[model samples]
Target: MTDPVRVVLVDDHVLFRTGLEVVLGADPRVEVVGQAADGVAAVEVARAARPDIVILDLRLPGCSGLECCRRIRDELPDTQVLVLTASDAEDDLVAALRAGAGGYLVKDGDPAELVEAVLGLREGRSIVPPDLAARALTDLARFDRQAAAGPIGQLTPREREVLALVALGLRNREIAARLFIAENTAKNHVQRVLTKLGMSSRAEAAAFAVRAGLLSPS
Candidate 1:
């Protein structure tokens, strides 16, 4: 038989963490190896246990979920992160993905789906909601059309391509693969696009893409 997936739960709420331990522990294929009440402890436990997957919360006391995700990706490259958050804001989702989260799930999601998402991550697949995916695609398309006709029409085709992907919630590495460019090259293009558009972050780019009708509404 295959080994069970090792998981570490991280959240600020003690009650929530306890409840999750009970639920996830009951699964035959999942083993709850550790639990942390905040991001700091989460990182420590993750490093110690070296779990296959880390179930992380978006908001914590010491460090935010986005920062935590970045740290986990850097420190535990082998472990996948699945984000569980109460916020469904597009910006938050984009931020989490950019920080290297393998999955993004709202708190209201069914327990079964959450477990399934964790299993899917273990199987090497990401689990983003269908609605979020549709929204991302719409944002990409909208950004494309607007950039084609806007004053910034001077942006080269390649820059426009990078812009659309950025608006679609893709990270540098993912965009690099999709565009057939080096990761550093992708990062450079994203930086240039942000500078040209006077934006500080990808979230701003996404919002601009949406407001400009560069993306279709889902």
Candidate 2:
């Protein structure tokens, strides 16, 4: 039998944190291992708990959630960090992703959606609220497009080709078949593209490709 997904909750509000613990605890597939009201304590608790997922909030006393997320990710590469906050600001979302959060969800999101996100993150999937997805992509592309002067130029010729195919909406398997490379090789190329472009997800990378004219805008 598979083990339940262990999770750590980090939020400043005691009531909110308690409510979340109860909500997530009700899931038979999940087990709440620890909880913290601040970033510093969050990391300490997480390091000790060694949970499969961390439900984090952007606002925290002392260590700011972004730094905490980065530290947690650096220390626990296997643990997925999911940002659960009330803020819908694009900058917050972008910063969270850049800090290595695997998922982002507003607190106003439905309990079912939040539950799905937690499960999805454990399965190695990136999660974002459906309502914010399109805007999030546009925001990420715009931010990177402005901060990065010719970000595509940073990629090798082969990576550029991979990015273009990604923009064309091909999955890794499809990209491998189209490029006549091994599937793992295609995935590596995609990872390289995302790393070089400072993109956390393929959606951001695809948007970057279009913005950079690597893929023709329709």
Candidate 3:
């Protein structure tokens, strides 16, 4: 049998963290190794536990999730960081991605999807909401035009579709439904778009789309 995907969760909300632990623990493919209530504790726990994936919250007491992600990326290069948070603000999402988050998930995401994201990370895939992915591409193009030029204009046709929806503020699952794809597949596209554009967040991508006239004011 394949080894379970080891995971450590870091969030300030005790009830939410506990609930997540219970939910994730029930998955035979996943193993909940440890939990931390704050970013400082999360870093320590992550180091000690050395789980394959770290599920982190963007907001936390003492250090913040972005800082924690940066630390984890720098120190534990082998451990993937997945951000699970309530905040969908473009800035927060981009910041976390730029800081080296392997995946980004909203708090209201289905438990099954969350489990899939953890597993996907182990497979060397990145997971992000579809809307965010679109935005990342749009932003990358804009950043390229403003920063220089050349290859930024070469986004694939699918990336353009994703960016248009991102400017509209749709979520990942919503995008998946619209495109007739699994949520995980949609996330994979978004991660690929972000990485290609050298962007870290959806907000940055949205702004770029607007400037490029890919999305008009609603």
Candidate 4:
């Protein structure tokens, strides 16, 4: 049998965090491994617990949830992050994605949807509310086009192929499998692609690909 998904819950509100814990814990498929009430503590707990996913909040007290997301993702690349917050602002969603969060969900959604988002992250999918997703793509595409093109034109043909797949939201492991390469090799390719493109996150890389006409929105 598969192991339950280990999760670290982070939010400043005790009642909300506790309620989510109970809600998510009721699901046998998920295990609440750790909890934090602030961004700094969230990072520490995540580092120590090394859970499968970190459920974060944007308006964290010690630091912005976006900062914590970046730290957790940068320090623990194997652990994915999902932002669960009350803020539905487009800037917040875009920032969270750009900070390397695997998914974003507003607090207004049903608890069942939260469970589904957690499971979706386990399956290597990015989750966002339907209401925000379309506008997000349009805004992301615009952001990419307006940003100065870095060394993107310097990428080799193979690297371009990888970037296109990234734009399609393919993770490194999936990219490796599709291209018949080692996962580590795929990871290296992705890192190099980001370096050459002067982008910090896969979300940005996808936008860059779209702006470059290497990928279509459809």
Please list the Cα RMSD from the true structure of every candidate, rounded to 1 decimal place: 7.1, 3.8, 7.4, 2.8
Q: For candidate 2, write residues 1-218 as lDDT tens digits.
A: 77889999999999999999888889998899999999999999999999999999999997999999989988997788999999998778777877888778999888888788888777545576655755666675655555555776788999999988876657788889999999999989988888888766554565557667676655
lDDT of each: 0.77, 0.82, 0.77, 0.84
Would you list the clashing residue pairs of candidate 1? 142-214, 142-215, 143-214
TM-score winner? 4
lDDT ranking, high to low = 4, 2, 1, 3
- Top-lDDT structure, candidate number: 4
lDDT of 4 by residue, 1-218 (tens): 78999999999999998999999999999999999999999999999999999999998999999899989988998898999988887778888888888788989999999999898778655576756865666666665443535456689888999998987878789999999999899889988998887656666677567767786776
For model 2, what is the alpha-carbon lDDT of residue 42?
97
Candidate 1 wrongly placed segments (more than 4 Å): 138-218
Model 4 weakest lDDT span, ten residues long: 142-151
Q: Looking at candidate 2, what is the lDDT of residue 35?
A: 93
**C-alpha TM-score for every candidate:** 0.66, 0.76, 0.68, 0.81
Clashes of each: 3, 0, 4, 0
lDDT of 3 by residue, 56-105 (tens): 99889999999998888778977889999998776676677678787788
Better of 2 and 4 by lDDT: 4
lDDT of 1 by residue, 1-218 (tens): 98999999999998998888887888899999998988888999999999999999899978988888788878997788998889887677767776878778898888888888888777645567878755655444544655545734656789888777766667788899999999999989877876777654454465455555555445
TM-score winner between 2 and 3, please give it.
2
**Candidate 3: minimum summed lDDT over ten consecutive residues — where?**
143-152
